[model samples]
Target: MKDSIGEKQVKVVIMKKFLIFIFTVFGLFVGWIAFMVYSYERSYNEWKSSYTGKIVTNSEKQFSSSSSSTQNYDYKKYSSSSDGNKDDLESLMNMFMKRLFPPTLLDPDYTYAYEKAKSWSKKHLSQQQIIIYLTKYDRYSEDATQYALNKLNVDWKEQALLRAKSYQEFHYSKNKLVEQLINIDKFTQEEADYAIEHVHFDWKENAVKEAESSSNGGNISKERLLKILVEYRKFTQEEAEYAIEHAKIDWLN
Candidate 1:
């Protein structure tokens, strides 16, 4: 009976030691996880601080200075460089953390921002226009919008021509067209000039059309139409004179 009692006490002591060992290991594991989380969060914050808030300029020349550098963060570069042995705890943790929380998630609306930007591009919107609408009206994050802008393959000259063509239905002189293209459409002078050079327009014909329209189907006199064309519509005196001669209007009326 005494031997049985001694064996029972030894078993109880061994069970207590085993329990203590298990608790110690569990506590260390919890501490390690906490430290890893804190490290990841701190690193992420530092990276974010350095990667955001770049400016996008309207000028092509200034693009490198104030542009989508922030949006162009190379995650692949980081991932590839950080690719160490799988047994490396720091490397494994970084990989795991990056996968668990991608940098794009920093802006909750990144998906919406890029998608909307693409839609705007398909509609033949200017880069400036897309940037403004995304950041100003839609309130998308600048980084995401800039990223979307950079991804787009756009021909600004072609866009300028398309925009210029849209003005054909209106009575705009070449000077007026250039002014509208540069000032309103945010196209560069070079682009606007290229557009004007390429677009199919007969300024004299447009002047005649304007003269007739100004006559309001012969409602106004030729002299009044001449004044409207040359003064208001910015047509040259020669063009306006041609328009007055060719347009179907009755000076007697």
Candidate 2:
């Protein structure tokens, strides 16, 4: 009986050891599978993050390029429109001045109007167009005062005389009229006489001197001088003759 009991106890111990070994092997297999799954998940998350970053960066660069192109296009359009408007304003103003004045009176304000017209023409119209308009209606807009003084040719003499006559009609100083007459050899004796009659006391002596110096011996025609003098409501006939006689000649004349 003692031997049988001892054999049974040894069998029990062997069975316990086999069961423990099987459980240990199963535990190790489970641990290896869990580790493999965790490593794979971590690698997948890293790849997804890298792909997302690339997509975001590409989108931002495209947006920047599109915005820059739009701004350039807008700037060019705005510049072209502004230039066109300025040209239009100039053309309109030029047309308005021509309609307001008659040809004979155009010279007085021509210089001021012409400058404004020129600025407009350069910015808005072609050179050919500007030349054509000026040629067609230039007589009416001619700057008379500037033309008379600057042209200084035989052709300009008539216009200067007319301007002097106009000044006289308005009762401008006789001294002013005399200065203009002295330069004009073509001035009739009547015009000179008229100038003499209106001559201020302060200017009479100077006039006589200027007339004497003239090649004509200051003897401008008496009849012509009388006509101009009569127009001077302020002067008597005797006063006009006395002034003419007293006038002295300059050496240059």
Candidate 3:
């Protein structure tokens, strides 16, 4: 009976030792996991602190800047930097982010173009203008950026006025302006007509300006200037006659 009691005590000690061993292994595993998490967070914080809020402009911008009309300006940019460490937790998180949200979903390019469209729209850009700016200059998806443009509530008639102003500043004829709006800028016939009728310009004075501009070569005869005024400029014969008669050019020479 004493021997049995001794064996029982020995078995109890063995079970306690086994339990201690299991608990020790579990504690070590948890500590290791915590340490790794701390290490990754420290690395991420260090990386973030070293680089924050930096801007880089495209030195070789390829877009046209000829039209000098002032517009409300808005722009946005996105960028990320890395040390090329593929095994880091930051890299894993970045991978997860990419999986969770693709470039299309994140759509930094679309956001950039959307903001630009909003700015240009506020400053009187036509829908076509915004569409062109996004697809041609910014190289964004035409459909997507256009969707963004359509989402904005803008004054189309005001845009037409702005378009008219741009052309009229260059002394475009009434018909020429309308033709450009319809054929070039994709405005409807009705919309073009509305813009043309509303824009405040004297077609006769515009004809005179046209005649003067062409007569600078000193080779424009009266008949040729009259043809240019009436046929090419879509002016009435009476208007053309008045323009040629009142033009500041030597048609007699």
TM-score each candidate: 0.58, 0.24, 0.53
Whole-model lDDT values for every prediction: 0.77, 0.49, 0.71
Ranking by TM-score: 1, 3, 2
In lDDT terms, which candidate is top? 1
Positional deviation of residue 86's Cα in model 3 after best superposition, in angstroms:
24
Residue runs of model 2 more than 4 Å from their true location after superposition: 61-253
Candidate 3 residue lDDT tens string, 1-253:
9999999999999999999999999999999778667766765665555333211123123134433432322112111123323334565565444444444476577567767788877766667777887788878797568667766777687678777777875667777888888887767677777888889898888887878886785667899888987788777788788888898886566
Error of 3 at 14 (Å): 60
> Model 3 clash pairs?
none
Q: Which candidate, 2 or 3, has the higher lDDT?
A: 3
Better of 1 and 2 by lDDT: 1
User: Tens digits of per-residue lDDT for model 2 on 1-253?
Assistant: 9999999999999999999999999999898777656655554455457557856986686567656577786786578778755654454443333334453364444554455445534343322333344545554243443332233223223433444554533443354465545543334446555545643334444333333433255445655454454354223455456555565422232
Cα-based RMSD of the predictions, in order? 18.0, 37.2, 20.5
At residue 44, candidate 3 shows an lDDT of 63
